[model samples]
Target: MIKCIPMIIKGVVQDFDNNACKEINLDSGNKIKLSLLTEDSVLRSLNSKEKVDLNLNQIVNFLYTVGQRWKNEEYNRRRTYIRELKKYLGYSDEMARLEANWIAMLLCSKSALYDIVNYDLGSIHVLDEWLPRGDCYVKAQAKGVSIHLLAGNVPLSGVTSILRAILTKNECIIKTSSSDPFTATALASSFIDVNAEHPITKSMSVMYWPHNEDMTLPQRIMNHADIVIAWGGEEAIKWAAKHSPPHADVLKFGPKKSLSIIEEPEDMEEAAMGVAHDICFYDQQACFSTQDVYYIGEHLPLFLSELEKQLDRYAKILPKGLKNFDEKAAFSLTEREGIFAGYDVKKGDNQAWLMIISPTNSSGNQPLSRSVYIHQVSDINEVLPFVNKNSTQTVSIYPWEASLKYRDKLAMSGAERIVESGMNNIFRVGGAHDSLSPLQYLVRFTSHERPFHYTTKDVAVEIEQTRYLEEDKFLVFVP
Candidate 1:
């Protein structure tokens, strides 16, 4: 008999094998079943009758406590996660362990809550008594509830989605990705172990169902939330946007194409190593991962040769775990296309690594298994046309100084971020993402404006009638 996975409802995990279960066999030789959510539980959350008034500080403290537990070798949370990865996901020991450690460190940061206050409410409002205007008071509150449709690319994404919701004091109902079914479950277990009665624990519900045309279930989930944050590629984002009710707001972090612009200085080999790390890390699945590299100098042969050498080094150190049939099929198709298109192709044994040198200009053709497209350009301006506002995300430039020199231009050209060549995968916690501070969007800022003596008001400081409206979300701060 196959071991059955439990379906989570309102923080309760129970056996759910009545009838509406969908069985799926993971690429890693594990068979799993997904059960439907309890209908009443879904409806009750939508109604919002049970208001959860949890203090944000306590929630942060609880997360800090959870992070501290990582030090306890016997009580480590990563052991279970690592087992899950090996059983059903494609993460190797190195990748799985790194994710667990990084997520623990991220949970320890106290700045996430501060960003909500500093970015949403003015920095002056961090202290209850310290006033931004000496008389006016302001506090950022939750938008009632948020439902997140998380992606399966990285295990830490589930933790990230929930952290933002809880920090803003919003109740959440998380829908985990099919590719990574055990990530949220492990974290939820941590929360329950610490304190089951904590309001933070009670306010969250982690559930999953097979992706299908069941509008009834998703509609109920979306209708009940004040906002929906959909983190996925184009297809997933479109699905959520279509199913969500018109009144509910949705934040779409859709598929984006990122690239590395390298100015080959004297140390050409060192430059290649930097670009190689960006390609190998995360298997090129992350939004910030560079899919294409634009080399701006002579000695193309030496750069490509060094890049191949670094890739071989990574293959031994940070090796890939497994690939599903779809990924394999994609590799085959891309290799054939590159060859037929008359592009110079360089690959390893059995398609382990493939490089298409000077491939034709295109977007969304990435094979995504350490397979990269390299382009040689006489001038950097050649890349400007491909920076489409609809899809560009990060532009990692060499030497760190190029990022500063080209930051404003890249921003204006529609790229949201410009990081150092080797640091594309790293983003500071509580920092702006996709050009907006995440906490700013997760909250609803409420102002306690003191009445100005009707006599005199400085026009410069007077409240502006118009504020920026983000689709259905209005982030208004009287200036």
Candidate 2:
């Protein structure tokens, strides 16, 4: 069977002639056809006027309702989307379902959205109206058009990017990743399903063009952007940076790695389970997913044994996605290299998972499918040298209290986020991503200054400045 995925332009579905459509072969032997948008069509779509004007509360409510629909397992769109993921991306049933649940959680949590605005901009109302600040009324204005270059490894990332732009009241022009084009389209369809004419829905346009194939359309689109949010590996990030207009604000969510630190937990089983969850949640694909474990203190062998059991359990519960021949070869070679290097190697049956324990802080190419490297250290501080600011993202710590002791050092070492061993995937409210609040980059903070009649904090009165300058009284007024 062939599935035809259409582009969503300003809340309308667009279908092109068969000649303009490209067919993609999926890992499950299924096929999907995507219509390519012409330059004129995209330009026209971009020029279409925004249909409705809505406030923050209205947009949130609409998104919440859409989220409620997705929360239902039997919702037609949600079910179809999960099935499509399984068919097109080779995701296991459980994994696909998990992704749907995450989407529900992201949208339904309305407070988090408001909190993001408040935390980054100093007031949630800043987006809707000018709020009084010191000596001025400040407002956050949406940077006109936001162009998103999404990554495929994590579908929720693209959704988050679009949501941020919407929350800031910016027009969104999303370029979907070829590896996973269905997620953003499905999200836009859901918006249309809720209310086609809603301003938030009408402000979004989701489409795709092969990266680097023809630079004409991308260049034109980049030229029109007020801000650009780029996500993916180094190459993709570079491409976005290189093509973005000089006047546009570019935000990059590039490649990052995470790790775990076990500081002699009281319950080795529980600690091991947490670490295993971090390792298996996204199969080490997310930046927050644990790639290495630094075990401090004793019971290292017991922790490893328990981790193995937990990993086996996850294999049956949330089975991994399919790996191509090259991936399989890389996994096997990494395991062999560990053995050749005289490191302790442990693997699961049928290559379900692999763990390599090294005597020192040694590293190599990570196969990244439930593969973890463990290093033994006498103290947690020893892990600092391995943490690099430019590339380190989340550092998970066992025995939650241990975080307080090492968080300062970890932050100084370039770790962007610190979380409990099991909570790597859940980004809490008020936390910074990639060392910056993403919303801050999507909008411009404009301040309305107070009138001259407003008195200065230092001086008693605000008289004419020329009079003070002519009288040589500026020094007295400054005091």
Candidate 3:
């Protein structure tokens, strides 16, 4: 914990001041100094990494400490943090607390076990026996697990990775996002307070540094860690991969693209309003948030109008980025004024929204700001080809029942998650983003295919469903 303090500090700097995060206003947007001993600075010092080294005992202690802290006062501390965070980020206190409580629940819950086992939709049941794999088992012991949490600007995506490591009883060294620095640190502080002697407390580290800062710190830490968990965009993932040691197991969580396929909208007002939440949630910063919507029916023009009216309401809440507004204006001027067809495509007060409607060849364009490329299609099938590789993460359907009829076709379109909810926030946040979850990435799962069975003749029977079933159990009873 001591050795990695600087790393957490560095990350806090970037989380608070990420070019995108800093552009928005939160709590007067006061700039704080967030820096660490640079790579050069570390080289100048003697035994820089020595302070963070830990034996097995300390690692176990840290995990216990984390459990105690979370078990005691996580909710209260998190509520306080949420209030401050809302003020800092300029978000609604209600919304912030809701999201914060969700994060806290995820951090403290034992749900990672379910997230890993229930890979598919199924009822929960208990298994009485132990399963083992080659050099790994159902209860695999991890020694030094270094978790590099690549935070998304979205609410709790980053914390999932950290929670996963903790559940596995790994000595977690979390690299939290620079955009939201203190969430993880505060959680860790809570643990340190509960039982300072716990190995998990001594084992945990939360800090931040710029991607360009001393790569050696993370590299060394990664080399020491048995597993490395990372979450972020392509650039962040690429950097983490480069810095991670060759022998370390890399569990990557990268940014994903999502979309909405609407069947019909009564009018433009309705379509616009429904799609507005997808764009405005966390300012459309979530990886699963939709950047494009393709309406599959002749009702689109009316849908667009209804969408516009509803969007106008949201414009009062969240706003668009300055750069995003300028770019759209430039495109509209040069491409002829009628491109939007008299549609009001401009920045609103409070940077609440930026609605852009233009004729696009397809929905393949990368999403930016609070923008969604509204594409009109004659059939939902016609839009299938437009889903690029990144569509593996999200596709929310309007009136999900009708969409399920063509579900097979939609799955072929490469979407991992489909729901009736038109808004992205309706999608469960703790699950995997592109076919992988935190537990799937943070802990290794290996299975043994060998079968172990005891016939009635081979073992004592516990119960019989009926007389006929009892006859089948006679062999075990005789034995």
Q: What TM-score goes with each of the models?
A: 0.88, 0.97, 0.69
For 1-479, candidate 3 gives per-residue lDDT tens digits of 11122333211212232231212222335333333434443232222221223332343355444444444445566656666466454456555655665664554444443444344212112121234533233433343556565673764665556655654456666666656665677666666566554445555666555676556655555566667777778888887788777777777767777778788644444455557777666666787777777777776667766666666676555443234345455434533443435543544444444455554462222335566667777776676776656545677777666567766887777777776534566536445556655444443433444333323333444434365365775454455
Residue-wise lDDT of candidate 1 within 72-160, one digit each (tens)?
Answer: 54565678777678667878887877777777776777675555456545562433233445456666667777888889886676677
User: Which residue pairs clash within candidate 1?
Assistant: none
For model 2, what is the error of residue 475's alpha carbon versus the real structure, in angstroms, after optimal superposition? Answer: 1.2
What digit string (tens of lDDT, one per residue) describes model 2 on residues 32-114? 78777786656866685453356788878888999999999988889988988887888889999999999999889899888
Model 3, poorest ten-residue lDDT window? 120-129
Checking candidate 2 for backbone clashes, the offending pairs are 389-414
lDDT of each: 0.73, 0.87, 0.55
Better of 2 and 3 by TM-score: 2
Best candidate per TM-score, number?
A: 2
